[model samples]
Target: MSADLTHVDTWLFDLDNTLYPVESGFMKQAEARMTQFVAKTTGLPMDEAYELQKTYFRDYGLTLHGLMEHHGVDPDEYHAIFHDISLDALAHDTDLLAALQRLPGRRLIFTNADDRHAERVLERLGLSALFDDVFHIGSFGFLPKPDPAAFDRMVEAHGMAPAATAFFEDSERNLEPAAGLGMTTVLVGAHAQDSHASFVHHRTDKLAPFLATARLKEAA
Candidate 1:
């Protein structure tokens, strides 16, 4: 069944792999940076650091969160270093830009990355003007997605009605709380096919096409 978007007045999107295709290697660069940061800070070998980075990401929603919790890492310092990656891999996605422009109402970015990283990515993709605002990890007090409390704060801060909002994310785990809060959840990317979670309202391998052909509720 197709999702009815007529009732959706607010569109929330995740950054990174959600907005851009994972094949672009943008996240690959970021992950490499994470590994380097971990190696430098923890004084571990590159391979061991990479493994630890993944462990932190798996245990904590964001690697930064894990570093903060265990290593008492300076959040600002870590953020600045982690996001210092090249955006050369990303290109302006005109199709996505056009699709976003066609959608009615508020369009916002809900990302685990900081606003600086989000801004740079959006700029690189030529989507800087489409979104109304960005709700980054800093906005959630360093609490990343999948944390129900972070979702609560976002909804409250934005003054959004859950039922009237649609959240598009690449991570199925992160979408769980959005669905639980009554927002329509759309899982994006190739991983969507692997999601067996009943909470996912829609699945699309690509976001531009989904938005292009969305079935909107009829105007009453």
Candidate 2:
């Protein structure tokens, strides 16, 4: 509340670590699946595939992009293989629910994962009804976050005014594009503190507690 959020009319959130705690192991499973797919597709050992996966992610912003560009892999197949994770380890967080409800505006999910993957995560977290729309990687034609094109597609599709938007994400790199687009960028996660960047307008280790601060300070 003290951060001058009055101008923010749209709440744009990243799906993974931003919406749910990273300890939930949701993304860990997806990462393992990505490594497995790369290993099977390229006939490489698991260790080599995992290293390649990490490299692709770092270089291309998305492993799917690297696979498509270098390996001529089908994006759909990679998506299905990588996102085919079990939601058994995940659970609903009512605290996150209350926190989100307190934030004023049209809330939307902007993620690198496909709709199918995003749906499963939201369903598992029992947050399916909270968001207005999910702008997935498919929606951006496979371009991932941190890419200026991806952010452009989101703004065009949602008719979002970047200056009036507040974007919350776990990745500092991702926040750079959002900041350049004029969004009030908030970095979420413990790893968020491991790096320092001018793009980040706010930093919080927990989404619920930070959002709760907005509500509590309003009531005060």
Candidate 3:
């Protein structure tokens, strides 16, 4: 009935949809920006660009990766333009920030977004200082999630033991590999439905309640 944080020393949290609710229009705005970027770079129409972006995300785990592999575009430039949207469109929720601060572990943000974007979002949510560090896309040579190399690098960089870490992500596919590496996996979105690993621990729509219960259980 409560979370056990005993074996978990590092809490790896996903940014975008996991930090904030996807229902918020912030995701939509970011998607639009990505679409526009693709269109501008490829000289395609908006709808085609949007489709291409989706295709790339589906195929390569990140639109930027696909762009790099195919179009030879600069990853930094793509991130700067696509993720430079206003964080003002997102609603403030400090309750989650408080919960994150109270969580019993070294908290780190593991996101596919660039560092600038991650910094902006965390700052807007008043959670910038709560985290030990942020592992952005740029951190691991633009290697995104679902890539074992990226996860491995994150573990090594943070000096974390795979068995003593828990990864909270929005994507089931991403969590699957982390689970395989012996990390407890918490799926934090509707899209994360199927996973073959028992280490895939919790599935929650929101993180605040989960964190509160986990903290209470730890106290008890």
Candidate 4:
């Protein structure tokens, strides 16, 4: 709606599944890398490592955060191993990139993944230059999202007014705090149906349609 765009001067997008569809198979490879990393780091069996990684992701907002807090794992080492997997499984979506370019105002990436991974993915999509900035888990003292502190730091670092920014993420849980901060929230991809995102302001299965709607609202 027009009301939504009135307060949104900046657009924050999530990387990974939010940028492209999950069907691309990039996530599958990434997940495999994460599982292997967990297995090697924890010295657990592959199956157990997978379960533990999932548990950490479920308990802590991110597996890396949980690994760091409880397992004493090195963040940089973990990130390097976990996110260094091949991105060849991902396909380019030029239409999405074009749609994003047409949107008005500053656009940035706010991802839970480390900056290195974000850069690689964006570059693969031909969208590396489209973003005004990239904020990653490493940006704010390694604190991952769903933590209000991370969002606050992002606001301060970018000199963004809470009411003038819109955050788009695939994870529903991450949207609530941003919404609480007074930013317009857009939940992207299939996870938009997740119950954790009940407070999100908008939901879209694809980025193009959402950007189109936002542009229309801005015009109105």
Better of 1 and 4 by lDDT: 1
Candidate 1 local lDDT, 50-149, one digit each (tens): 9998898888888998889988888788879756688889998788887888888888899989888998889889999889999999999999888899
lDDT of 4 by residue, 155-218 (tens): 8999998787888888888888998988888888866655454578887777776675554335
Off by more than 4 A, model 4: 1-6, 82-84, 191-197, 216-220
Order the candidate numbers by lDDT, best to worst: 1, 2, 3, 4
Best by TM-score: 1
Query: Candidate 4 — which pairs collide?
Result: none
Query: What are the candidates' C-alpha RMSDs?
Result: 1.8, 2.3, 2.3, 2.4
Model 4: lDDT to the true structure:
0.82
Decide which is better by TM-score, 1 or 3: 1
Decide which is better by TM-score, 1 or 2.
Answer: 1
lDDT of 3 by residue, 72-181 (tens): 99987887775557777666687886777676768899999998889889888878888989999988888888889999899889889888888888787788789889
Per-residue lDDT over 78-139 for candidate 2, one digit per residue giving the tens place of the 0 to 100 score: 78775556788788888988888887778899999889989988988888988999999999
Error of 4 at 89 (Å): 2.4
Provide the lDDT at 202 for model 3. 79
TM-scores vs. true structure, each candidate:
0.95, 0.93, 0.91, 0.91
